[model samples]
Target chain A: MISGDPLSRVLYIDLSRRKYWVEDRRDLFEKYLGGTGVAIELLKEECPKGADPLGPENPIIFAIGPLNGVFPLASKTVAMFKSPHTGNLGESHAGGRSAIAIRMAGYGAIVIKGASDIPVYLSIYNDKVYFRDASALWGIRSSHTVGRIIREREGEAGYRTIMRIGRAGEKLVTFANVVTETYRHFGRLGLGAVFGSKKLKAIVISGKRTLKVSNAKAYREIYDEIYKMAVKTPAMRKYHDLGTPANVVPLNNLGALPTKNLTQARFERYENISGEKLAERFLGRRLACAHCPVGCIHLAALREPYEKEPYFYKTTMISYDYEPIYSLGSMLGIGNPEGMLKLMDVVEIYGLDAMSTGVILAWTTEAYLKGYISEKETMGLKFRWGDCETYLKAVRLIVEQPNDFYGALAKGVEYASSIYGGREFALAYGGNEMPGYHTGPAAHAGFLTGSRHSHLDSAGYSLDEQAYVKKEELTPEKVADYRNTYSTRYNKGGIHKKSSREIRQLT
Target chain B: MVKRIAVLDVDKCTGCQSCVFACTRRYGEAGVGKSAIFVRSLGGVERGFIVIVCRACKDPPCAKVCPTGALKPRRGGGVILNSEKCIGCGMCVEACPLGAIFWDEENNKPVVCTHCGYCVNYCPHEVLGLEEVSTG
Candidate 1:
């Protein structure tokens, strides 16, 4: 780390006391670096063993890497907490102006501890921190509205990042997410529920501080090299043109696209919802995270006529990716592009983790088919595949949680299926809903053994694809060996092997 | 011929801030504090962005308000800042209608664009370009 770099400063905010302080911990920054490395250490230091995830003891830590504002594509902000969903280590990465805003605010990490007695939002501008009352902003119907209202109320327009939750988060839904920059998110493991538990409605941060580099000439030369490569690369062009939805057609062709609760690994109507189709028909805009030359975030414009006024129509710009398409489109058997996007819009409005919510819904649909659950438990709505209207209503009920069934559903698929007698087909690993992958044993092993139980943990799906191309059989021992190799290669000589006892606990 | 950076299409900007960083890099730095060019969103990014820079106004408002005569009109249009003579009163920052004069908080001096067109090379979307105009 550079001497006098603001990356060594850690800002600690205690909502319980409405007090905040800054600590210069060059020791931790030097050893752990930043982002996940520093965040995990901070979590270990502040969060006590056996701490309740939704309680005041489970601290919320947000950290950014040293290269965040200094370099392009180092745009992610790592969030660490004890998850309300899994009751275990929670880590999610989000891209937007989040990392840049946090870094420019002159801190590498922010630790939010304790709970507020009343609803409040934290406003952080450079070194100043204010706990503003959010009484009027509470219980908002749409998360987008919350972002818009905060955007109007906040001082900085482009420089700030507003991270807030919607009704699902306020209701403490176990899979609720924190929406950042209106579209990006800490989208998994219930970070928003932790915020809800703390009565933290939102956090608005911005700064205009200048960052320093040790060597200016070398920095400019390397920056230009990277900038040139990013703009000229074909891979980046694909991302800018079609985004992650480009994976849909190929995954479906490979028979790795999980459909209808993973009962099948191929969707028959995949072409209708593929990236090419979406770009041709509905691509409205493309966005990029701060400092990134490649603008990959794709938004689809959905224009529909108002019911009362036939001639009047409203257009909505909703962002989409491969995971959401798999979860809400193929996995739910909803092939209609409009319907899939509408369902996605609802999930965004409520600020729920789309993958978890889709998997949970798939479990319920299967459970209904198996006669384990009935329409009575569903509160008069039938659980059927591709019925967007019914699924929309069910999502609302899950947030509302009017009955025991909805309450169970609000917890997660793991908990819901355990109580509802569908454990065999629950499709969750480590108490978290499965991501959009069913490639081979490596992907499954990665999910079962990965620290976060996420596909991004080790990218086992990429390994599965490699093996598929080579026509090689994948065994459990082979996966374990590959995982070790992956860890040693990428994790700076650290070898990771899960113990049998730990595996049992995770499963 | 005098060359000035022009915003080709504001809608093409993704609010990436690459140009902002590039402006700073031109001075052998890596932050936006000294950058004369800024891309701020109109309320939110969803609506689009407004690129604010010295449009090379022939008679710049910022230069007219300089108490220390630190700001001299450039040949192209915008004003050039002489940091040695600058009193750092920040009068020029409030004088511009476009708010293009960025403050260097650390140095306590105004950062005004010299119409060098260094940042135009970094705009990936072709949102910015350098245009040659007659110095009438």
Candidate 2:
């Protein structure tokens, strides 16, 4: 029922003093728009240069766009923080109830700063912000359990977003992630580590507020147009049908799918863990973001025995996306879909970034193969591709940090490879792990130069494919220039004084 | 003959809440509180969704329980709300078996599905359809 400009309210919470305040930052919202734009400006304002990414000074900012509550695919919440992994601009986008919940909560952005003395979780209900003690919630083995606990305790059923991390984040793993709604995540560049550093465990957000639009008729027209296109479009239909894992076979066929630690672009056993196979065999359910009609989040029901009891079994619903499939299945040489799901489940339980974990494990496997470090460094365990059991153990060790090697691995592939050798095949860009694109030089250059060094940063791989079809010769310099253009356009974060006409033109 | 929103395929419901938004938009507002139709997860999304909507009962319990005679059985199966006469006692919200009675927090009124089929148009999967029923 609360009205007015919901997009202008910026909520800031200081964990150190347990204080919360709202700022009317109309300038930032009006100029930058929202989501990435607002987050970037906040990140610049709060995160000082060379500030410790894990320090109390580093801020955690979550922003949702103006179109978030109103539009379908505009369901992403952009998280900006000084990454403990990358040591640079850390930006990750997650689609869940996160954006919608935040938007409905009557805020364009929420910034959490300072560190808490004890473990705690933030619950924002309408105008109230409660810093509840999360001492019991801390050290929980499974993030899934944590989510369930939060869900049971929280009042709002479908209208809230529960974001939590597990032992990996508690242990401050640089590649740890914050899982939201069990399936979606702020799953890159160690936001979980930052949360751990702040002694913050989880955040539950829910609100019921009416949003105002300039023109309702135009809005409805635009909404229908976009919705029709999104539902009927072939590209989006593919996403809706098989979800993102549908890209596996096609990317492999095109020799662009990174496999076995990027030693090969095409995974030979791609069909075994392909999207079609997974959908055919184990697709339990398909889910959409809060507003998105494209149900791209595919869950695979993994049933396994209790090991001790012959008849006892548990069916675990594990969510799968293309990046996770590539990182956990193809990159680590996991041919079996079940094994891949198991590994992904483990990663999710521990709240580790699957992509970073896979890349790190791939580097270690290759390192072991090259005799850089033996069983001694690996805590007497053999590292091999397609061996998910040992990989699971290794992932556990990374979170537990039982040994120095595991401790190094917890820092991410770039830092781990730098310490233990095998830097050549580390498969990391800007200290973050590489995505599943092995398209061309432009892709690599985009990864190298993109602000967040993410495939999503510029989608240079698609451009590379376009250039490839046209037989356009793209040098490393040209690729870098192209990437630079994107960085300059989107990455330069600041509050720009612009005329209303200019803003209209830009929109 | 009158039409009602029918959840033809529950499995096709992805829990997007587009229908909820679409329904609320009919009131010239944004958000789901005012929407007559509701979509929620069954424990978790992996299990599935429960699409809550008015089934247009033959002998509507909501109309029978109304204290102010605000809710009256229409020619069809559903009930029409007389906002002027009604007190927001929420008796109808509890009387419904399907939990389809949505409370508009701002106005303090029971917003039930009018069977206008606005939400049916926005359902991308065609999981929702308008089915004609002859009132006896």
Best by DockQ: 1
With a 3 Å backbone cut-off (N, CA, C), the pairs that clash in candidate 1 are none
lDDT of 1 at B115: 82
Q: How far is candidate 2 from the true structure (C-alpha RMSD, Å)?
A: 6.1
Candidate 1 chain B: 10-residue stretch with minimal lDDT: B40-49
Tens digits of lDDT, candidate 2, A320-354: 88888999999999998889999999999999999
DockQ of each: 0.71, 0.63
lDDT (0 to 1) per candidate: 0.87, 0.86
After superposing candidate 1 on the true structure, give the runs of residues whose Cα lies further than 4 Å from its correct spot. A483-507
Query: How high a TM-score does candidate 1 get?
Result: 0.95
Candidate 1 local lDDT, A315-427, one digit each (tens): 98889988999999999999999999999999999999999999999999999989999989998988899999999999999998999999999999999988989999998
Native A-B interface contacts kept, per candidate: 0.64, 0.51
